[model samples]
Target chain A: MTYWDQEKECMARDNLEKLQLRRLKETVFRSYAFVPAYRAKMDAAGIKPDDVNTLGDLQKLPFTTKQEMRDNYPFGLFAVPMSEVVRIHASSGTTGKPSVVGYTRKDVDTWADLMARALVSAGADKRSVIQVAYGYGLFTGGLGAHYGAERLGASVIPASGGNTQRQILLMQDFGSTHLACTPSYALFIAEVMHDMGIDPAGLKLKAGIFGAEPWSEQMRTEIENKLYIKAYDIYGLSEIMGPGVAIECPFRTGLHIAEDNFLVEIIDPVTEEVLPEGSLGELVITTLTKEAIPMIRYRTRDMTTLSNGECPCGRTHVRMQKVLGRSDDMLIVRGVNVFPSAIETVLLGIPGVEPHYMIILERQDNLDIMEVQVEVSEDIFSDEVRKLEDLHKRIAKELESNLLISVKVRLVEPKSIPRSEGKAVRVKDNRKI
Target chain B: MAKQISVFLENSSGRLAHVTRVLGDAGINIRALSIADTSDFGILRLIVNDPDHAYKILKDAGFTVSETEVIAVRMPDSPGGLADVLDQISEENINIEYLYAFLGFAGGDALVIFKVEDIKKAREVFEKKNINYVEAQDLYKL
Candidate 1:
């Protein structure tokens, strides 16, 4: 009924810098007293807590990585005691072991507030009925959005992903005003809504907060066009905090990082040297106000840039560009580095193959061969073996032209490939190396 | 010589039409045909009047057409004829993946399309027993 975007932070540069310095000092001191690992790292660098007097000295601190967190495992680096932790969330461990993160009661409240701030930034208010369709449980997206909507004093509908028909039915019956889920699922929901003959524009929904997977601007435009709502991007890693670490304002320029709670830095991915603003590199985050599992200069592996320039929506918190790709997820195919997201963009633009597909890399005779198994739907007319074979050849040729690498194409039945409610696994490398 | 071409197809509506259109354009006449379709992918087995020519056309058109050996057994349309042939193949330890009758009652005999584990052994057994084998010309006529 009513829409009110939250007031954006518009502090002057000098004042914001002073605030960040003060917070950085408190964070270093707290880490020295509570987090022994960080204290040890700082001591090894021959620096004391008092030595980091300014933000410029942050570069002197040792950088943490996902591997480091995994090496510590479970609760090894938790700054607070077990009694202080009220909740836990874990990253989807498709590559290796799952990295676990803990939250104290205050930390949970902080996460809720940040998520609520994200919802408000997307133009939701207390009168809005929010539907959170992200996966619940160990995955943070659902609860992160759930608590955030609740904190906004809105009517929170904890839909929690899957069962498209039911999700749509609730959307219609409950008059849900806000949606929170992965961008892919949001598009799928839009498709379902169209099939059900429910006009998405007529729905009470005003905005959507989509994340959990890297999506393109094309996908954002597609989802917004289909759903008829203003779409926003919410960014966070469970290791740092849940989905509220940063969010896109109405301008959709870049995600404004919660500088008061998290300090963001960009460094050359290969060289590990800190880069000037606007230069794309690996994103490094340091939790400035977290109680449990307080991290110092954690290398996120996410590729993006940080800018302190004021956004049109007026959030002065340092903004990060939309994540281009993940460093670890890049695939080296025939000496050419390829990201699955790039492949996804190409696949979605093609007409024949459905969105569901699998890229399999296998070693054959000391050479890596890429095989793409695409799902064929009713749109494809060929049922005869010869015709199907011809289609496969055509698709392979198209992909070869686009990717600049030869690939074999296999047509599979719809829904044959495995589906995931969380992060979908698109690339499967069977190569021993 | 007649050609036997194997095609890979997914089972769906209008698929047969699309495949027929390609062969029809190439001026190839199907003497006999059979299908081995699962829920996922299907294999279309065809014996064309002009085997070599049809195989080239389909292959050059980017179809994964492979040559396979299939037997053409002539049997009476009555009930015991197919049962007897199956029993004989079973005794010879030859497994039949799929089979279909090519010619109808106009020929007074049914042509059974068959795939066996060992084509040589199955042919030998059929030959030694003097089972009537349908010729390519006779099949085209039917």
Candidate 2:
């Protein structure tokens, strides 16, 4: 229950806001002065560094987006000289170009501290043995957790993802107390553990910090029960920092942002207007203390809400609920908005069905069709065809009821869908658009 | 009690050809084959020369395969010949899950394959009615 930095974590609201305003002014000034991209963006918007005296002036500043990062390409948006930049990480864009992010030495330290705060908020301490299964390199997950665990003075096992059996062997041999990885990988680890005839309760594991992909309460319960550990949600993006932007404390209510380092805002994605607190909208963040690449009002595209309520854990930062889904990931089928995560929540709630699924959207005779290919258990597949068809109809009916859009459901054999060690790709849009 | 190999396949181009290529390369002959398809996927039912070998080869080739028991009845090639057998089975209250036909000769009696809910009951009914059922080895020879 020990705080990593009690003074900064539990700072008074008035003091914290004053600090945020000061950091915001400095960040805006630095971005306008150094980086040409932000400079032009602000200049076009008729904004000056001196104009940002109050925190509300942030809305007047231009917002940086992922497309802007791509247009800038590698190192185009970095504010500092290459010499001062200590490290660089790029997201796996998988489409065109990766969005590169640079970090100075001081920036790295700030990132580690925020991650450390995140780990401690989830109940990890100096004595905790952390197994960082998140993939290292280019991706921020592995290295991010690694630095944070070291900052927390914990013994870190940089497992670096994949090789589940070996991971389990290490988890058992090293008596690891904490796990860091995507929630899907945690379930995979549990699956391998059962195959190895290893009981989860026999392990010294207690808490799991899972993120990097959207997961549901049903999945959290599944991971907790399977691994016999308390699963905590951690949130971050490579564009901002890494795995420590915000995280859920033991209260398990919402993720607490590192308000001192990063300023968070919610905005209507379509209108691009800032929304009131407690309203779900696209997440927008401005790096308050970032030195290498000062992101001025970067649009995160993650849909969520901000609640400034005082947490039972005593942190003064506003808490963001678990992200509902990314606005970019929303699929408009037959003019009806649907999210793959929403379908996942429904599919996971049903019995005899695996959590693996793929949503295929296609155009047929000018009509939009969505097919949900879900993988059921082997037992279900082996059942009578009538029973299998019954399961299929049941899933489709449930989905139509929840999504308000009829969808075709196909029951495929177990393992028919491809599995990923990282974020699961949920949608395949075959429309020419 | 004749064994039939059933494979799950998506209704995509060259999918059935892929399954056939695997079995043909394994030196297994398809004695009789029928495909039941839905809008999305298809089930390829095959009475092969070696059911176990065909199942292994199809499965090893990453196809969803299972061996099922189906009765192959020898019937007259006349129009009512197949109908008579189906009518007798239906009268005995046994449901036919699926059925397919093969030529006994160029223009002679036909070999009809039937997958029923209860293979044992179907056999009892066939025996009581003196319906000639093809054995797995004998059918392979044919």
Which has the greatest DockQ?
Answer: 2
Fnat for model 1 comes to 0.10
- Superposition error at A339 for model 2 (Å): 1.6
Which residues of candidate 1, in runs, are more than 4 Å off?
A: A1-8, A95-97, A191-202, A351-353, A377-402, B1-142
Model 2 chain B weakest lDDT span, ten residues long: B101-110
| Candidate 2, residue A365: lDDT | 92
How good is model 1 by TM-score?
0.72
Maximum-lDDT candidate: 2
Report RMSD for candidate 2: 5.1
Q: Which ten residues in a row have the lowest lDDT in candidate 1 chain A?
A: A1-10
What's the C-alpha lDDT at position B115 in model 1? 64
